[model samples]
Structures are given as C-alpha cells and as structure tokens.
Target: MAIVVVGGSTRNIGKTSVVAGIIRALPEMRWTAFKITQFGHGVCSANGEPCDCETAEHTIAVSEERDALSGTDSARYLEAGAVKSFWVRTRQGQLAEAMPRIRKELAATENAIVESNSILRFLRPDVYLSVLDPATADFKDSAKLFLDRADGVLLPEGELGRPTWKGVSLRLLEGTPVFAMMPPIYVGPEVVAFVRGRLAAVAADV
Candidate 1:
C-alpha cells in the first residue's frame, strides 16, 4: 500500500485542508485517512485533557464517513471520497504503543494518508510533506525533529522572507521543494500537481 504523510510545524496551518484536497483530487485512490493527535504532560492523551486515572490503552477514535458534508477532519476525508477515516490520540512520546492498532487499520486499506509528524518515526511513508508558516513563530519539537526528512514543504503565501526563532534562522527550509500555499483554503493547482507527480512516480516504482 502507498502511504503519504501530511505534517506541519504547528497547529492550525491547513494540514487537514491539504490532505482533503489531495483526497478530492485523487478519489480513485480509495484512500484511508488518519488524523493523529499527541498530548503532552498532565493531559489524558486519549481525550486531550487533564486526568488522574490510569488508562489501560491509548485512545484511538475511528470515524467512518459516508456523507461529504460532515465538518470534522474525518468528515473532510469522507467528503473527498476516502474509503475510511480515523483519529488516533496518544500520550506524548507514546505513539509506539498505538502503532499495532494503526497498522491494522492501514492494512485493511489499499492506500493511506496520515496527518501527523510523529508517525514518521515508525513508518517511512512514500511521501512526507511539511506545511509551514513563517509568520507563526512557535515550531513544535516534533516538526523540528523531522524537518530534514520532509520530501517537500508547503509554505505560506507571502514575500518568502526569512524567519527567525530565538536567534536561530529558519532559512534552512528554503532549500527544499517549497510550494507557496494560500491559507484558509484547499491546496492550489501548483501544489496539487506536485503531489500528484510524486505519487505517480512512487506508484510507477511499485
């Protein structure tokens, strides 16, 4: 099966929209989509809240959408014609515990697209796209850890200027295959073409 991972430097940067756009553009792939959320300290990794009780297993919420109008990320995948959709939640640094279940879900599909950065640690996807916004200064540790592994980067629409963080330059990402993205919308044709071409090439190899 083919796997594509969509990750970003931080939250609310349109990673979900990008995944939806690709699923829509290539409906014939019959993709199984996944959205993974990792929670940090003092939070119930399963529900993204503070909890004192011990849980037996990490929470993995799966939502299958048959209608296109549903508004959740899983719904967006459904709207794009994905065969199945799931949302996986785990404690920070504990994604390894959820992989067996995740793999079972992925094994049941023909092709899959996952929205996560930490998922990269366990699986080497066919394509890894990193979404970034220079205007946003807070970069997640997970994003920094996998920045160099990104096959391509989806940059925000702006002058393409240099970004600095705590005296460190963010210009290193400029060298990668950067696609300028228009925010608050689905991906444009240029980004679409780039993804399609990469997927096509990977398909040819298999």
Candidate 2:
C-alpha cells in the first residue's frame, strides 16, 4: 500500500483541503484517510479540569460514515469518497506513541493518506507534500523541521509576497517546486498531476 502525507507550515493552511481533493481525484485508490490532531497542555476534557495524560495511552479515534458525516476533517474525507476515515488525537510531539496504531490502520487499507508533518519521522510516505502560504508569517517548528524533506511544496496564490515572522524570513523556501494554491480551495490539476506522477514513480521504485 502507498501512503501519502499532506502537511503545511501552520494550521488553517489548506492541508485538509488538499487531502480531500486528492481523495476525490483518486477514488479508485480506495483511500483510508487520517486526520491527526495533537492537543496542547492544560486542555480540559470532562469534569472541566486540566489533566495530565500519558501520550502512549492516548486514544487513536476512528470514525465510520455515521461519525464521518459530521463537519470534521474526517467527515471531509468521507465526503470526498474515502472508503474509511480516522481522526487521531495525541499529545504534542508525541506522534511516536501513536505510530503503531496508525501503521496498523494503514496496513489494512489499499492506500492511506495522512495529514501531519510529525508522522514523517516514523514512516517515509510514498509522497510527502508540504503546503506553504508565503503570505502567512507564522511558521511552526514542525514544518521547518520537515521542510527540506518534502518531495514538493504547494505555495499560495498570487505573487510571491514577503512573509516575516519574529525576525525570520520565509524567502528561504524560494526555488522549491512550488505549485500556486489559491486560498480556501484544494490544489489545482497541475499540482495534483505532479503529486500523482511522483507517487507512481515512488511506488515503482519500491
């Protein structure tokens, strides 16, 4: 099975939309989609109290159509015609604790698409696409850590404008294989074809 991971420099950067778009475009792949979320400290659950939880003991949640019909990212996957869907939640920087379960889920599918940058540490995906918004100044350390490893990048639409955050310049990403991605939408056909062709090559290499 081939695994494709879609990640971005920060949140709200169209990573989910890209995954859904790919699933819609490649329905024959029978993709099993996963949307991973890592919660920060002091987040409260039931009883309205902050709790310290072990990362290893964290649950890897799965949602079929009933749970998938909602407005969550997993639901978007289902709406895009994914055969199966899952929403994995874990502690920040604790993706390793969830890798075994995640791999188990991927192993059961014909092909899997995961949406996270941290997962790159455990498994080398068939294709790794990093979505970048040159206009957004905030760049997460996770994205920076994995930037050079991306097979290709999806850049935001319009002219390549300047983006600065805390004295750092995003111009460092210039000259990468960047596909222009307009706001609030999935990537265009050129980017999708590039990804599919690259993924096919990777599969052949294996």
Candidate 3:
C-alpha cells in the first residue's frame, strides 16, 4: 500500500487542506487518513485541553472519525472522501506508545495519508510533502529535521520571497521539487500528479 504524509513547519499553514485536497482529488486511492497530534505538557491528550491528569490513558488516545460534519481535522478527512479517518493524540514525546495501534490501522488500509512531521520518525512514506510559507517566521524542529527527506514542497503561489524565519537556510530546500499552492485546495494539479506518479512507481516495483 502506498503512503503519503503531509507535514508543515508550523500550525495553520493548510496541511490539513492539502491532505483533504489530495484525498478529494484522488478518490480511487481509497485513502485511510490520519491526523496525529501531540499535546504539550499539562494538557490532556484525550480532549486536547489543559489538565493535570498524568494517567497512562490520558497520555494517548486514538479515535476513528465517524461524523464528517464534526469540523475536526480528522472529520475533514472523511468529508474529503477518505474511506477511513483517525485522530490520534499523544502527550509530548510519547508518540512511540501509540505506534502499535497506528501500525495496525496502516496494515488494514489500501493506502494511507497522515498529517504530522513526527510520524516520519517511524515510517517512511511513498510521498512526503512539506508545506512551507516563506512569510511565516516560525519553524518547528520536527519540520527542520525532516525537511531534507521531503519528496516535494508546497509553497505559496508566486516566487519564493525572502523567508522571514530565523536560523533557517534556503539551502535545505535545494534539489527539492516545489509546487505552487493555490488556496481553497492546497493540493494543486501538479502536486496531485506528482503524488500519483510516485504511487504508480511504487506499485510497479511491488
């Protein structure tokens, strides 16, 4: 099964939109989508809110999306045509505790698409696309660590203006394919074609 991962440098840069766009663009993939979230300290992973709970159960929680209209990121995956959608939450630095269940879900899917940079730590996807906004100044360490592994990058439409981020070098993006991201659907035709070609190559090798 082919796997695609969509990751971003920071929040609110349309990573979910990109995943949903790809799912909607290629419905035949019958993608099972995952939205992985790591809650920070003193936050409850179960409900993604501030809490003092330190129980094991509160450290990790995974749930399948059943309501497409729920407006959650995982629910958006279902609304975008994913056959199955899951929301996985884990406390900071504890994603390893949730991998077994995540793996079982992966084993049952024809293809999978996940939204998280941290998952790259355990699995190598057929296609890994990182969404970048040069104008945005915040760059997460996970994104920086995995930037070089990205198969392609999605950038805002137009020339890449000077990046406002500190301690980030454009050299990291060198030799990587860049696709223009037009809003409403961050996955453009070129990005879709690229993902299809990658998956096709994987199927051929199999």
Candidate 4:
C-alpha cells in the first residue's frame, strides 16, 4: 500500500484542504485518510475537551469518521471521497500509544493519507508534503524536525519573499520540489501530477 502524509509548519495552514483536494483529485487511489491531533496538557484525548484526567485510556483516542456532514476534518476526508477516515487524538508527546491501532488501519487500507508532522517519527511515507505560509510566524518544532524529510513543500501562490518564522531555515528543503497552492482547491494540477508520478513509481518498484 502507498502512504502519503500531508503536514504543515503550523496549524490552520490549509493542511486538511490540501489532503482533501488530493483525495478528490485521485479518487481511484481509494484513500484511507487520517487526521491526527495532539492535544496539550489538561485536555482529555477521549473528547478533546479540557479535563484533569491523566489515565492511559484518556491519553489516546482513535475513532472512525462516519458522518460526512459532521464538519470535522475527518468528515471532510469522507466528503472528499476517501473510502475510510480516522481521527486520532492523543496527549502531547503520546502519539506512540496510538500507532498500533493506526498501523492496523493502515495495513487494511489500499492507500493511506495522514495529516501530521509528528507521525513522521514513526512512519516513512512514500510521499510527504509539507504546507507552509510565509505570513504565519509560528513554526512548531515538530515541523522543523521533519522539514528535511518532506518530499515536496507547498506554499502560497504569491512570491514568498521571506518566511516570517524565526530561527527556521529553508535550506532543509534543498532539492525538494516546491508547489504553489491557493485556497478552495489546494492541490493544483502540477501537484496532483507529481503525487501521481511518485505513487506510480513506488508501485512500479513494488
């Protein structure tokens, strides 16, 4: 099975839209999409709400999305034509606890598309796309840690003179393909072609 991961330098940078666009653009892949969220302290993973619980059961929660009208990121994946969609929630630095379940789902799928920079720590996907915005100043350390592994970087359509993020270097993306993306449909024709080519190449080798 082919695995593709879509991550962003920070939150609300259109990562979900990009993943959905790719799923819609390549429905023949029959993608099983995943949206991974890591909640901070005092938040319950079971429901993603503020809580004081610190139990193992409350540390990780994984649920399959069934309603396309739920207005959640995983629901958007279903609406984008993904055959299956999962939402994985875990406390900060606790994603390892959810991987067994995630791996089981991945093993049962044809093609998988996951959204998270942290998952790179566990899986080496066939294709890894990182979305970034020059306007956004907050660059998570997780994004920085895996930036060098991105197969392609997606940026805003306009010229990115200089990223506003501090202490972050673009040199990590040396030799990596960069694609310009806009809202509504973040995956452009070129991006789709690149992904298709990459997946095809992987399948050919297999």
Over 1-206, each residue of candidate 4 has an lDDT whose tens digit, in order, gives 99999988887778999999999999999999999888776764334478544445577888899999999889999999999999898878989999999999998999999999999999999999999998989888999999999999999893466889898887897788989887776999999999999999998999
Better of 1 and 3 by TM-score: 3
Order candidates by lDDT, high to low.
Answer: 4, 3, 1, 2
Q: Estimate each model's TM-score.
A: 0.84, 0.84, 0.92, 0.92
Which 10 consecutive residues of model 2 have the lowest summed lDDT?
45-54
lDDT of 1: 0.78
TM-score result, candidate 2: 0.84
Superposed by TM-score, candidate 2 places the C-alpha of residue 113 at a distance from the truth, in angstroms, of 0.7
lDDT of 2 by residue, 1-206 (tens): 88999988777878898999999988888999988777656552211245443244444443344466688778989999899988776766666777788878887899999988888888888888988776777777878878777887887773456665554445555566777777566678887788789878887887
Which ranges of candidate 4 are over 4 A from the true structure? 42-57
Local accuracy of candidate 3 as per-residue lDDT tens digits, 1-206: 99999998888888999999999999999999999888777665334477544445567888899999998889999999999999888877788999999999999999999999999999999999999999889888889999999999998893578988888778888889999888875887889899999999998999
| After superposition, candidate 2 runs with Cα above 4 Å error | 42-65, 166-175
Better of 2 and 3 by TM-score: 3
Better of 1 and 4 by TM-score: 4
